[model samples]
Target: MFCTLLWGSAAPFIKWGYDLFSISQTGDILVFAGVRFLLAGLLVILAGSLLQGKLLTAGKAVMTPVLTLAFFQTFGQYFLYYLGVSQASGVDSAVITGTGAFISLLMAVYVFRYEKMTANKALGCLTGFAGILVMNASALTQAGGSLMGEGLILTSQVFSAISAAFIKKFTRTHDAVLLSGWQFACGGLALMLSGLAMGGSMPGASAAGWAVVLYLAFVSAAAYTLWGLLLKEYPLSRVGIFNCIIPVAGVFWSAALLHETGQAFAPSTLAAMALVAIGVWLVNRPETPDKRSENQTCGS
Candidate 1:
């Protein structure tokens, strides 16, 4: 829940950064995101080295997972997410990101086979998705969502789901924090290179602006680290269930923090939130022994 809360802070902060730093171009946003993740990666590495009292070495197994995670989870996901936020309202972005829960659930059940999909699980995902549709229906039709906006967020979140599955598979071999740190470093480097290639230039900004950037880095490092630890301890489905709270937190934060945007949320949003909460319950609820026995019999 705490990790998800930290992540929920992202959209509003990114919007605020763009305004504060005068970031108009997509390349510029990429550069900013790159810097944030780079530092986050470094911080995690430092923490790991300190805990071990020695420099950490990256072998083939470590580098393989780190690089893969960097590309898909850190670099690919954020690239799309930042770009999507640029073209969409913060509230819309938040609501759209809520889809991550469903994506993660699907991956957990089918791809990783980490958890079996029961009737409750299926209904839970459907209910959560229904909430997402309801929450976005007004904005998508009235305010309009472009391919660049909602589409990109949708794509990135699927990558996030894939990353979760990978993390679950990899953590048994490597230290979670170290893997997280390196991935963030690799991702940041990749993003900046891409941004520069795309003609992004970093301009001088206010000290406050830099502070905001650092805060973002800090948030990424802390949130991802905590999440890495959680994945190390829990099943992907369990950790993923908490994500249902993120969009609600994000929309609330955006409405509260970035009020100048004049985003008027509808009463239906409240009902939509209720639906999502219920969905979380359904997804997270433990199955009965009888249900598991029935499932095993069916499989046999």
Candidate 2:
């Protein structure tokens, strides 16, 4: 819930950055993305070192998973999402990003064996998705942007799912903060290099640009480290369920910050939210003895 709230706050900041810097302007995307991740990576490393009294080092055993996580979650997912938001409405972007929960649930159940797929789980997921659809129905129709942008955003969710699965695997031995810092560092470096390769230059805003970069770096990145820790400590099914709240919060924040007006509590939106809430309940509810036995037997 805390992580979801923090993430929900991010849309407003990004929107502010976009409005101030014109996200689609030449080189702005690359510069903003690169700087934000790079600074976030650095800050995480510094914070981890201070807290633990030493730098967290990755060994060959953890290298593969760390790099895979960096590539997918840190770089691939955000790159696609930022680009999508740059092209589409914020509401659309929020909806598209919220799909990560469903993808993560599927991956956890089928690929990682983190959870068993049951009728209740399926219904829960469907209910949550329906809520998301309601939340974004207005923006969905307005998503007349380039299909490429939308495709990239959708594709990003796959990387997020893969990262969630891999992170769960590594949490067995590694500290979440250390792992998250390393992933951010690796991904941030990759994004910076990609920006340079694309001939993207830094934005020249005098104050606001730098402020936006700092906000993204410190708030978004550092908060995500905490989020990763929560995921490591809790069941992925449970952690992933809270993601449903992100869109709800995002819509509320967008209205509050941007003063964008629409039907804030439309009947469809309320119905969808109710379904999503029920779905989350189902997903996070304690398992019965039979379900628990099945989970243990399946080694989840």
Best by lDDT: 1
Candidate 1, 1-300: lDDT as tens digits = 788787787888888888888898988989989989999999888988998898766778688999989988999999999998888777767767878988998998787777678888899999988887776676567654445687889899999999988988888778888898889999999998888888986675889788888888988888888887888787777788888878888878888878823543666677677788889999877789999776556433
RMSD of candidate 2 to the truth, in angstroms, is 2.6
For model 2, the stretches where C-alpha displacement exceeds 4 angstroms are 59-61, 135-150, 263-271, 286-288, 296-300
The 10 consecutive residues of candidate 1 with the worst lDDT sum are 260-269
TM-score of each: 0.93, 0.88
Lowest summed lDDT across 10 adjacent residues in model 2 is found at 88-97
Candidate 1 overall lDDT versus native? 0.83
Off by over 4 Å in 1: 143-147, 260-265, 292-300
Candidate 2 lDDT over 70-128, as tens digits, reads: 88888888877777666655444555567778789999988877777877778888877
